[model samples]
Target: MSGQDPVSSPARTDSWSSKIDTSVAHPARRYDYWLGGKDNFAADRESGDAVAAAFPTVRTSAIENRRFLRRAVAYLAREAGLRQFLDVGTGIPTADNTHQVAQAIAPQSRIVYVDNDPIVLMHARALLTSTPEGATAYLDADLRDPGRILGDPQLARTIDLSRPVGLMLVAILHFVKDADDPYGAVSRLVSAMPSGSYLTITHATNDHMPPEILAAVGDADAQIPFQFRSREEFGRFLDGMDLVPPGIVSVAEWRAENEAGPRPSAAETAVYGAVARIP
Candidate 1:
C-alpha cells in the first residue's frame, strides 16, 4: 500500500511484535522454518522438525508448493490476463512471491497479500518490494474474518473489487479446522471476486498416503493445528467454479510441463492444487 494507511501490514507489525508468543508454534513461522528461512524461532524449528521426521519429503513438498504457485501466477497473468491478485496466508516473503511473479509477466498487475502473523508482515515490508508499475500491499488479518478483509478501505484502494482478481489460498487452509468454518470463509472470499476471476489453491491432502505414513502424519498433526483433507473433502472449497486444465492434481504436477526438470510424485508431494475460473 501507499504508506498512507495506518492499518497497513508494514506499520502494524512493530507494535504487534510485542504480543507475539514465540513459545507456541505458529503455522507461518513453522512453514518458514521448513522452507529454510532464518526468521523463524526455536519453537517453529522444533515443530517443523517433528513434521519432517514423520514425513521426510515435507521440504520437497513445500518447495513444490511454491513452484505450483509460480506456475499458477504465470498462467493467471500471462494467459488469463488477470491484473489483480489477493494472496491470503502469504508466508515470509521469498523468491518469486505473488507480486514479483505476476509483475514480471504483467508490469501493471496489482497485488494485496494477507497474513495474520506480524513476523511475516515485518519481513514482507522489507523483502516484498513492489514494482513501480504495479501496486503491492500487505494486510495483517486473519482468514477467518473474510468480511473484515474484504471491507478494508486499504484493500479497496489497492485493488478494484469490480475487476477480475486471482484469489490465492496456497498451503494455508490445512490450519483452518472444520470447527472454524473454512468453507464459509472461502465462500465469502469467492463471492467478492467478479466473474472471470480465478480461485487458485494448493492444499495438503492425505488421499495418496499409505497407512504407515498416515500414522506418522497423525503423530505430527497432534503437535500442530493441521487437518489434512481427502480429495473428496477438499472439493468442498471448489464452489462449482470451472476448473482449469489438469484439474485437481498434485501440486508438483499442476502444469508442470512448463518446467524443465522432473516432478515429484503425487504421493511424495501429498498436496493437491488447482486453478479455477470463477463462472
Candidate 2:
C-alpha cells in the first residue's frame, strides 16, 4: 500500500472515536456478533437475533459467506500470485480473515481493509494481522467514499496500485442502495486498478427466499436504509469486466470447495457472489 498524500489507517488518528454510535444497530457490529465476536452491543445482538429468527439460515449464510472470502483469497494469493488486496466493506474481523487466508498462502500478500464502522475499526487494530513478509492496514471510510479509499495514505503505504490486486467486496454491496450509485462506486475504484486486477463481490438478493422471508429481510434492511438488488442489478457491478467461470452464482456455488447441499434457489439463499477480472 502507498499513501497518495500521507494517507494512513483512518484509525491512525482517533478515527474510531469519530464514528462510533452505541445507541443503534450498525451492520458491522451486528455481523461481528453473528460471527461470535465480542465487539458488539446489546442493540446489535438483538437486531442480529431478530434477523436470524426471520431467516433461520442467517448464521449459516454468514459463515458460508466468510468461507467464500477465504477460498477467494487463497485462490488469488496462491494460484494467481496476487500479492495485494483491497477489501472494501470488510466487516468485523473473525476467524480466517482476508489477510490471514492470503498471507497463509503467500507470506508476502499485503492487504488494506476498508470499513466505515467504528467498532470494526477498533477490532481491526488487533484482528488485521500480517505475516513477517506481508503487511495489513485498515481504512476507516465508507463504501460511498471510494475516493478516500483510493487516496488513503495508509492504503498507499502498503499497496502498489500498478499491480494486480484482488478487490474483495463480499456481502457488502447490499448495504449500498441504488441511489448511492453503487455501480459508479465500484467503477471509480476498479478504474484505479490495473488491467489484470480482479473484482470479487457478494451481494444479498431476494430471489431465493419466499415472499415472507423476503418481506422480513426487506423490513430489516429498511431499518438499515439499504437496498438489496436483483441478480440483474448485481451483474451491473461487473459491467465492463469479464466474469470468470460460474458467472454470478450463489456464494455457496462460486468455485466452492465442498458441496453444501444442492445449491439453494437464489431467493432461498439471498446472496449472489462473483469473481471478475478488470479487462
lDDT of 1 by residue, 1-279 (tens): 543435435447668778788898777788777777887889888878888898899999998998899999999999999999999999887778999899999989999888887777567664346777888877778999999899887689889989999999999899999999999999999999999999999899988888898898788768677889988888779969999989999998899987767778898899999999998
Task: Give me candidate 2's TM-score against the actual structure.
Answer: 0.90
TM-scores for the candidates: 0.94, 0.90
Tell me the tens digit of each residue's lDDT in model 2 across 139-246: 778888899999888888789998999999998888877788888899899999898999999988776677888788666655576677789989999998998788
Residue 121 error, candidate 2, Å: 1.4
Winning candidate number (lDDT): 1
Scored by Cα lDDT, where does model 2 land? 0.80
Candidate 2 ranges beyond 4 A from true positions? 1-19, 259-268
